[model samples]
Target: MTRLSSPAHLRQVRTGNMHAVLVAMLDGPASRAELAQRTGLTKATVASLVEPLLGQRILAEGAVVNAGRGRPSRPLRFAATGPVAIGAEINVRHLGVTVQRLDASTEFERRIEVDNCRATAADIVTRLADLIRTAIAACGRDPLGIGLAVPGIVQDGAVVHTPNVPSLNGIHLGDQLAAELGRPGTTVAVDNEANLAALAHVWPHRLAGDDFVYVSGDVGIGAGIVIGGAMFRGRSGFAGELGHVIIERTGHPCPCGSRGCVEQYAGLDAIFQAAGKRDLAALLLALDHGDPRALAAVETASAALGAALAALINICDIETVVLGGSYAALFDHIAPGVHTELDTGVLAATRRPIHLTTSAFGRAAVTRGAAALITRRHCLEPNLLLPPGRRQ
Candidate 1:
């Protein structure tokens, strides 16, 4: 027996009209002409797409109010009530999970701390499945998909490589966890944490444009790239492995078998070790107490980070850079050194316009980006919202 009948699923897929409805709502309330202009589809095409969606109650039409000297425009908007999607961000030390409607209004949220990233892949899957099940029970919504943002390399929805964390070196983390969840038709999506943070942070400021970079420092360092308004996950899905890039040939030994890697200096462990503390909070407390050693370590890390960012600016030329993660709070202390490096290292022609700022979402941005990843753009398709067995 075919576990899930394709013909039946296809019929259901055709009935929902979710894609067209979501596209309409994304443009805000608009008339046919307004939506057409914003979406770049002809007015007739917009009408054709919207009619079925309207019938399904996914798209709502308002009164055709009269506009003087023109056709009365009937505005359309997405129905506020519909299926909601869940986004989960699994980091080295914690998980940030959120649930929101397809229209982007957030519902409930929760965070939980699990075992260290050193936990075996099986352990990770079991614990993650439990967390997700708990979230589903709490949210009480039909989840369309699950988006996971992890601190490592992702290719075709799997964690094929995690350089900083040895236990996850070769695990197909996504597929295993998805299977453990027992939601066969549920869509599971995965991406590097930095990439998701970049998407989550840049989406709100998208009116300014899409080309930007997101850099985060935590247990490890990572970067997410956005070019031409879309994530550019380069060949082999390791494009943004900025943390492993050799900064100094003989600086310090990194666990990834490299010396003087960015993570050796910019990662939380390095900062803590340099400050002679077990935690970043303790180091910050020492800094507050006028502990010179702690303060010096912070400055050194900042200068190294600044130099690295400047080098990247010379190469990528992104318009903006957003810093995130557990160590993002250090941006305030290191701004001076970062400024100094950017002033000196970036090419003169492309230097002045680049802006560096701390991420507004802080540690939660990567998780939010994971959620967005499951539902945004050409990425969204019928299978995105389909039940598990029907999905590829």
Candidate 2:
């Protein structure tokens, strides 16, 4: 790529190039020559970028290999102990916290099942704060930043309101957590649960597609959308409200002051009630036994889920849809019916078949997403995580 005339533009291009090089390294260890080929940068530019990284001990050289025809080269890999990030989440049925390294690997994670919706925000924050401390210590190093994912609409690190879980409404969770944790450097972030789910889909899971929708199913249904390798947060950052999408006009009433919404038909309660079972384990075992009642209930839930997803797919035109949370666990029992509806329901099914799959991260998706959100910057631009003097 050619540089612009202005120095500001030149710096921007170099930053972009630097980020590209770091992303290439994320795949695995490689020599400078290999990094040049992967990032499409000249050897000289790659060397210049590597200088600052090497000085900062962000990238370390491995044992030299003599297999090459021209010359021996030492493979360079991300330094494991330089810095890390802590990620945590609060959902209807659980709370979790985790620590992740700059190389996109989990250092440690802890999860607890609790009725967060019924608990007070202060109490939940206390427990989450404790977990965050535990996770930080578990990492065996200090964290550079921290992030959080919550089940409500978050704007500027505060919870506007949560319909399904009212206790979290009007909670400035981000500000409170930041004050509680007292970490500096402006890396803390607060976002919706499903958006974090989408972020997790990209990293740890490595789902193959730049654009896709992740549907979360626990106490309610949530959708996280990715567009152009980043989240599509709409004009007000309130996009991807998949749970409230209307499916039946005169059906059941929803907490959102809407009738016959997707959650009413596809949420955990709907499936459990349809199967005449209250617990998830019992329902899964019954389905494993090929029980007719369990199969029918799953079909009922899948049909509604597919119907809602058909609308999402038509509007978004994304071919990939991942079922996370409880939906992912039961995707096998529900995939067939969901596919049947998609085959007949979508406007362009023949052109692009909808690929339905389960969340590889499962229940732990949000926590990992929290960490990925912070460390992802380091993946793209290592300078983002380094101190000013150490950065290129």
Best by lDDT: 2
Model 2 residue 141 CA deviation (Å) reads 1.4
List, residue by residue over 246-330, the lDDT tens digit for candidate 1: 7899989887778999888878888888889987578878878979888888788887887888888788887677778875677
Number of the top-ranking candidate, with TM-score as the measure: 2
Off by over 4 Å in 1: 1-21, 31-37, 40-48, 54-57, 60-76, 202-208, 288-290, 349-353, 377-392
**lDDT of model 1 at position 39:** 61
Candidate lDDT values, in order: 0.73, 0.82
Per-residue CA lDDT of candidate 2, range 1-392, in tens?
A: 54477777777777788888778887888999999999999989999888778877778898999874868998899887667888888888788888887677787888888888778888888888888888877777777777788886887777885787787888877767766766533467888888898898787446748988998887788889998677898887788888888999999998888899988878888888888887789999999998898888888888998998998888889888888888878888888988998889999899889888888888778878888888886766666755787654
TM-score between model 2 and native: 0.91
